[model samples]
Target: MTAQANTALAAEILEVPHAEAAAVTRDSRPLRLITCGSVDDGKSTLIGRLLWDTKAVKEDQAATLRRDSGSQNDLGLPDFALLLDGLQAEREQGITIDVAYRYFATDRRSFIVADTPGHEQYTRNMATGASTADLAILLVDARAGLLEQTRRHATIASLMGIKQFVLAVNKFDLVAYDRAVFDQISTDFKALALSLGVRQVTAIPMSALKGENVVYSARSVIPWYEGPTLVETLELATLRSGQSTGFRLPVQRVSRPGESFRGYQGTVAGGAVKPGDSVAILPSGQVANVKQIVTFDLVRNAAVAGDAITLVLDRQVDVARGDMIVSLDAQPQTGLAFDAQIVALQPDGIVPGKRYWLKAGSRRQRVQVEPVQQLDLKSGKWQSADMLQMNAIGKVHLSFDETAIFDPYELNRGTGAFILIDPDTNNTVAGGMITAKRTELGGLNAHEGRVILSLPADLAEQLLATELLASRRDEVETRRVTTSAARQLLDDIDG
Candidate 1:
């Protein structure tokens, strides 16, 4: 096409009426979204275009961007990537290395966008961003199509429980706005999305640099395509609810204003609470009735998820920070062992039987992490793994020194997520989600309180020599037997 034809197409697309966009009337909470793709797939540019088209960028900021970018694209517009790649290292390297969060709003709704790094090494950061997102925008270059990183991001977002997906086939202009290429990529992504049990998928062809089909339509340029713009889809998308599970509030503080007042303070994590409701203090199993719900402004008769309030119980109980206040009828799982999926972030990765600090909600305790399997992103398979290296996603077992509380992540994300902190370095090493409480007998019968160990004689002797064991030698039973005798005993038990 000639330059005049390109200009005409652009004019037609721009002149298309905004009345075609979907209408969203209700006043809903802000929708959280994440942009992810392979390296240089235009994640930053997509966000920048959204901001610029929505007029979220100030004039002085735009001028500074123009000055700093120091060059204009062929479209005579400032480099949109400069708008979001704020870190000095990112600007210098021209690649996103960390998660950048930005906020913008349309006339219909508001949004919080997390632009995550696309490099495979920063996959942990991508997981961190996706954990809280209600929707995911998976961008792919039109020329490159669906790359391995694209599939990896999609899988992580789905596992993190993001049902809404928007496949932005970006840089369509570079491909001469070919509809067949767009359709092929969309069909391929749809198959992937279906495999992940995601039914809400919207695929759009867009040019983030030229601001096509982002906040506006590209109908004139790509006359064969018809769908909601990215912003329109986002505006119509529903917000994920925090009250999907039973009532829960992980105590963050205990407020005692004076002799007359005693309350537990925390943001309501799941479900709702009202006066006269029976509640329990977890890990302690202390039960009480809800007396009142107090906030900064006044006492409320009820409180729901997202509300920050102080709960006053009918009677005094042993409640403290890190303790969970939950509905007595629907108590959260409490056990010493749990199964979780994790993304290893540190260079050393997750070592088998390594003790680390686990923090969930406001609670922190020592835990031993054991890797069960690591995901093969390219093949979409789980392979047995003893240790998870950097950026590896794996399924693991967590054994805690003390009882831990959690709900399945699918039921309640806020109460089901945790982070692992390295004891020696004090750096966060992994993010994890509770899959289930490791139970025996399919949860039909309770677990025995005793632990049986089988070890070599030398190792057993070394373990028994530790100060901890030496102090409690009389507390636990010990036995010594030959391998043949041990085998015979096991055979007898089986018989």
Candidate 2:
């Protein structure tokens, strides 16, 4: 397909599929990825091999690794996991405990790999890594085939919007390079990926410790198998993009650096914006035109998602930290109630109807979260639940005292995702994504409470005479006020 067609396909992937966010697009930026699987599945070894073969490892670091390992693996190489597992406890326990990020590059591409822990206890860390990744490398032992943890990791990656998956059937050498075993494992993983609604997948069989099929080809020993190496798959992978959604800039802060200059500063979270475009300050629903798009370097005609720029409005408006600046035509949803899915990250789990701080972008507000359903990994189903335990993935109901603005997570990851923090400890307890707004009040729109519409007096009367308006005439309260009064009301609501 053409590059333009590929770009369009990338945009399409970020949209809602099956009420869940599917594979998000990745672009020219460095690919962000995570290594995930069951414990002792060679995740770290795969990464170390990538770094080594790519020549990303320095002599000093390799020397340190050799000394720290005290012994070498059968390949006459220092313990490869040593290159990533840096913690003292991790080295002693021979397992990864925290998420370790490493940067490496090849002639064709650059990569930021998050080596996530394999144990169930550190599942939270894995989620953190998956949040920003464009692809996931799911490792599994060739002998063990697919395990519960393998399923869990794949599920979380899919939920986090990862579209591309690489199944690394590690330790093929230990399995005597069994072609049948590799074929079976790949077949099982393909079914799992298909169930997750992920169609972009490539499975490869290799021994990471022996450095076969990681950075190099595996056809030498496994003569029957023919496929690209692990490095080649990643090199061809894409990075996630936020430009598919309409223009959105979650105001980080109101910048008034000097008495003469004032602007709203923040990174563009979605779409693109330029001067002369009409924009809306949301939650307040105040409209303004983009007077200027300011940057430290110089002014530009346009800025797309991920660009950091200051916006100067033509006239003063009630915009503050947490308020969203978006294109008027493509406004996001504003509501008092929303539905979400979350992964409980703390041991305390999530208590129903408990108020916590919900932070999304630069916006932070108090929210009451109630668990609605918990995911059953074994059966791949969701069951009703009143509360969620640590490492539990569940759906929830969110109640806010004030207006909450969001796009469905599938439409825009930046504005649609959030985190819940424990008030007592200020610890982030859960990572979540918004599913949709709850419209509970009898056909009343989710973006309810108050609305201001301007129309000719005769046209308004003609509208009130309609059947729909006449049916709910008692519920409709009409008032007329000067433009000044309307502005004051909006400001009061914002406050």
Candidate 3:
């Protein structure tokens, strides 16, 4: 058979031979990414450029940009940053204050890019964006080099389990697009990333405003550089391989629109799922088989990592939004308590014994701050403390009212990340991840007390026996004589 015939046959088999109601095809996989950097570092501009240069932006949106071009302050060019400045405050302040989401696709892949705020005060926003991102793009200014904020952002990203990083040295035009400046920034950032436990770092030089080396290569400008452009790097980047040891799906919604169908919808947190796959409903541990996976129109026999679908079960099961569906073979963890490292972002310090809302994936539970360890950003040591201050990175012990499925932040990014919100104010004060468990009792005792306690039997005997033992013996004899005298006097009086 011809190659085209074989291709067509394979496509037909994928569409038909599989259960017509549930099919597995190649068109469903997508990469979820988050772009993070300090404010004014061109994160929004880069994303806007990526969309425009790739023709991902619609004609009407492009026309809007063209109409607003005359009002632009910078060179009277199309203000690409306008594409992401969704809020009035953001446009006025010229900074992204909250997390903004945008979707675009290429022929080979689709993307969900989260544009996060970058100010020191908005670290919680950055953490929220980074928690679910498979890849992180860290933008650096060529003129500024590696600032403290850059290091802090990278550290937070690494702590959030973002393994893949793309370091885009933006504003190359400001530095005259010098290769030396780019190399210096790249080397310095790489060293910082290595210390932060980042797995891979790819550095690319680009001018986001000028659209140099963004979607296409800037051969004329940077002839000395031989690597791929920012777009090319994203396109060629490898997807994370290896099946998840634990199967987890956080139930986002449950639907039973009619008698013909009943389904639970959620993004697959980890591992794989298929029709007939045995899954355990979390918080209850009831077992059932996946009957079918359904989306808006596409129903799939199987859904792997990152696929958002509705699952129909073989047996009637008690499942609800915020409850987790996990594989029986790889059961999800359930406990009312766990430990996490939280970066407190609110001005009011995190108080102990205060109830805060813990949001992990689609699950939210009431959790209390049991204890706050000291901020470690300065000394890199966990010290004892009662509360966490703004911009403070510290380890905390949190106790939830109910148990939920969780993975170590080191293992699964989707399952292991969480945030702390003030229950009364509904303000997110801290963002954290479960690093390790503080299982030992009296764990905080070691950090307290100015002097050490030593109860040595031999030492006690040496001091007390030599000084007080002899004196106490005479006093005991005197007390016994007085008691005998008192008894003799009482007998005489009775007689």
lDDT, candidate 3, 19-38, per-residue tens: 53233233345676888776
* Candidate whose TM-score is highest: 1
Best by the lDDT measure: 1
| Runs with alpha carbons beyond 4 Å of true place in candidate 2 | 1-28, 443-495
Q: State residue 438's C-alpha deviation in candidate 3, in Å.
A: 4.1
The lDDT per prediction is 0.87, 0.85, 0.74
TM-score of each: 0.84, 0.83, 0.71
Q: List the pairs of residues colliding in candidate 3.
A: none
Q: Which ten residues in a row have the lowest lDDT in candidate 2?
A: 15-24
Deviation in Å, model 1, residue 495 alpha carbon: 14
Which tens-of-lDDT digit does each residue in 1-495 have in candidate 1? 333343344345433433443343544589999999999999999999999999999999899988886655667787888888989999999999889999999888889999999998889899999999999999999999999999999989987888899999999999999877887888899888877767778788999999999998989898766666898778767778877788999999999989999999999999999999999999999999999999999999899999999999999899989999999898889999998989998999998999999999899999999998888888776788999998899989899899999998878898999999999999999999998888755564255456556678999999977533442343457789998887787777669
Give the residue spans of candidate 3 off by over 4 A: 1-28, 66-76, 238-243, 250-267, 274-303, 306-325, 343-349, 357-366, 374-384, 390-392, 401-404, 425-431, 437-495
Instruction: Give the range of the ten consecutive residues with the poorest summed lDDT in model 1.
Output: 1-10
Estimate, for each residue in 367-419, the C-alpha lDDT of model 2 and write its tens digit: 99989888886666778899999989898989998899998786789999999
